[model samples]
Target chain A: MALENVALEHVPSGYGVYVGFFRDVTNADFLHQQLLSRNRDFEYAFIDASSVISRLHLLSAVYSALNTLLVGALRTPNVHSEIVTSFNTNNNIADAYRRWGITPGKTKDLIVVKIISPTAEGQNGFSATSARTPEAIWAHLTEHVMGKPVPVTDSEIAQATDWPKVRKYYRLNGVPALEKVADKAEHQRKMEQLAIMGMALRGL
Target chain B: MAVPHQQQHQFPLPQILTHPSSSPALLITQGAEGRLYKTTHLFPDRPCALKYRPSKPYRHPILDARLTKARIAAEAKVLERCWREGVPVPAVYAMDAANGWLMMEWIEGVPVRQAINEYLGSGESQEGQEEAEELGDLMRRIGRVVGALHKTGVVHGDLTTSNMMLRRQEGEQKGVLGGEVVLIDFGLAMQSMSDEDRAVDLYVLERAFASTHPRAEKLFGMILEEYGKSFKKATSVLTKLEDVRMRGRKRSMLG
Candidate 1:
């Protein structure tokens, strides 16, 4: 099969893929061979930039929509964590552009594909989609896929309790762990309430 | 910086009164805060004053530490500020805020109130009539210093002659002539722009004069007139002073 026709699956969404184009098959082969000789795992293909662009086009559209959604979600009150995750994911996509050699003045066209994976703890499951460009990848993540729920760690539970010692003990570095510890502490603290209830029940 | 001259005194408490090896001066002043001692420079033989803020039992340890640190810092800052403004106050030598003590220059003179009283009452032994005339000039200088202090926005909350020092210049041929008036003890000084506070300062001094020195009214009048010349803002204060004198600082039922 031709390199342009080859498709790799399971790439995470919001991640950028770079495809370098050569003028002819011989030139492309020569470049690929040279890269392979220097280092292991060198992979290249003969394809026009337009072919890669077509494949990523749908992915780009989805990313753009997702980016808009994420921005809106961030603007909402108390969605700071969502905003941070979105921004960080977008930054990763931008870095992919640099890796592809897609310069402003370069005559060679390079295609970048972005793959965004819903976070593991997020309610939505993983979905693979192609992005034609970096911007398109951003849109897909923000518009289509709902944000994944962040995992709660022990440290987060400790922090929420405002008991620094307990938080430190759990080694939880995020909000969820702190919340967990606070909930546990609060439940344990309800012993007083239970005692009061028992006293009222005894009188009844 | 010039290493101040060393002064020596024989003190009973070695820890409280440390003698610089060069000078044998003993520092001896006791207060609620701590004990103070006078000493001389170890190398230069210049006079220096030492203040030791003692620990208080009434205050919690943390609060005492905070208070001692703040008081020492404030006192040092006030002295430096006053010195920069050409106020004849003591130059700080060393400070131990944690210990609640500050060491400054040991003023080599009698307290102004003591000098004034000695001259006005005894007038026989110290320097004869010449000394009495000199006391007049010294009193006027005291007034000028007070005016200067007020002009600089510093209200010496407790303005008493005992807080003023009349230092005779060292090695002078003439006896007790050309004495410099120095102000001391800034434990309660606060920065203010209020004329009322300034007036109250003058009133305190006036009362101090009446109670301490004989025929103080006449002498204080001379000081007041000189003070008026020193500060153009003194007129209104002097006017209010007359009213204060009448009211006697006690509220009447008529009000």
Candidate 2:
């Protein structure tokens, strides 16, 4: 229950994607420092859950980043950074990190994504096994991240979602499409769809 | 003898579809600009239409890549714009314009061309007034969609029955010429606010509707009537459409 090894469709079997959700995260400043210092152990995309609309929204970004990585066109430093940048609807990496990435004191609920590449140790040339196992990643996350581990489901993510931030980030506010939806659940679904579309169509 | 099905497709697939997935990708249709494939690449339960514009061999490699990328980006941008404006168009799921592929929500139901043809072909005798009313309603739906699209400041350059889909409603009983009208195929679409561009769009559709559904060409006026009432400036576009009908989709150069 600590980490989920998402079996995303169309992704190459060589790569592994694991996601974890933590609520009421307290050691965000310490964790944020690890990312800033370039610690090898912290090679993960730490996202602020408030900006995420749903599991599909998060996975869309992951898929986009994975696609970019597969084609050898990753603009960010690594696949993890690319995943964070994939959440933005523009080419501003710095703004994406600040808005979606983990920030000290501000981000209460956190979403962490770790991408294990097959070619981790490039010297060996395309290793058959993933660089890290899901169990080890889960254990490390539970030990380090000071928060309650929650399942990465839509309902749970919805609890942490900040609608205002999401609306601003995806330009979902005042969208004619959403205004036409009357049902509450349908409205949320439409918002999620719009956000996913925004991320998919990033950078024009 | 490993995966012999890969050889079935007439053309080589894009790089993205070659990866393994729960369900096999099926080539749905092929157009001059690109090919459409139905694949569950985003989610196993969700299907998406993947439009891929393969590079041309005649053009230089760099030029072909640039053109393909630009077309994919332009198509995706227009789709997103229409979708945000509540226009009945497929929402973009994912796209890699640089890779010359765009993934969009797979619209269910037949193309408007097929539905209208089926309705018109069902009887040698004239369709009853009730049935005629049903077809008129569909035309109005088309009008509203095209009007909404134009109101969003984008013109669907390729306006034809084939480019529009009638989305099947879940609980509604299946019937010819039923369901919501969803516009598709925006490869030639562009953002424009000019009445001239909008008029040319309607003119193209009027010509296409006449040829594609000649039996029911008279009903085309219903579409224009609804379109005229849809937006603030639609009246002007319809007026311009009359001139376009006379000039034959191009401005005359007579001095």
Q: Let me know the DockQ for model 2.
A: 0.80
Checking candidate 2 for backbone clashes, the offending pairs are none
What is the TM-score of each candidate's chain B when compared with the real chain B?
A: 0.81, 0.94
Worst 10 residues of 2 chain A by lDDT: A122-131
Candidate 2: tens digits of C-alpha lDDT, residues A1-204: 668889988888888889999999999999999889877677788999999988999999999999998998989877888999999999999999999999998989999998877764532222233238888788778888999999899999999999988989988878888886879999998898888888888878
Model 1 lDDT tens row, A109-174: 322222233343221322223343435543532333222212122232222232332223222234
TM-score of 2: 0.95
Please list the residue runs of candidate 1 whose C-alpha ends up more than 4 Å from where it truly belongs after superposition. Answer: A1-204, B1-25, B41-44, B123-133, B173-177, B247-255
**lDDT, each prediction:** 0.49, 0.88
Q: What range of 10 consecutive residues in model 1 chain A has the weakest lDDT sum? A: A195-204
lDDT of 1 by residue, B204-239 (tens): 888988887756556788778887888778877788
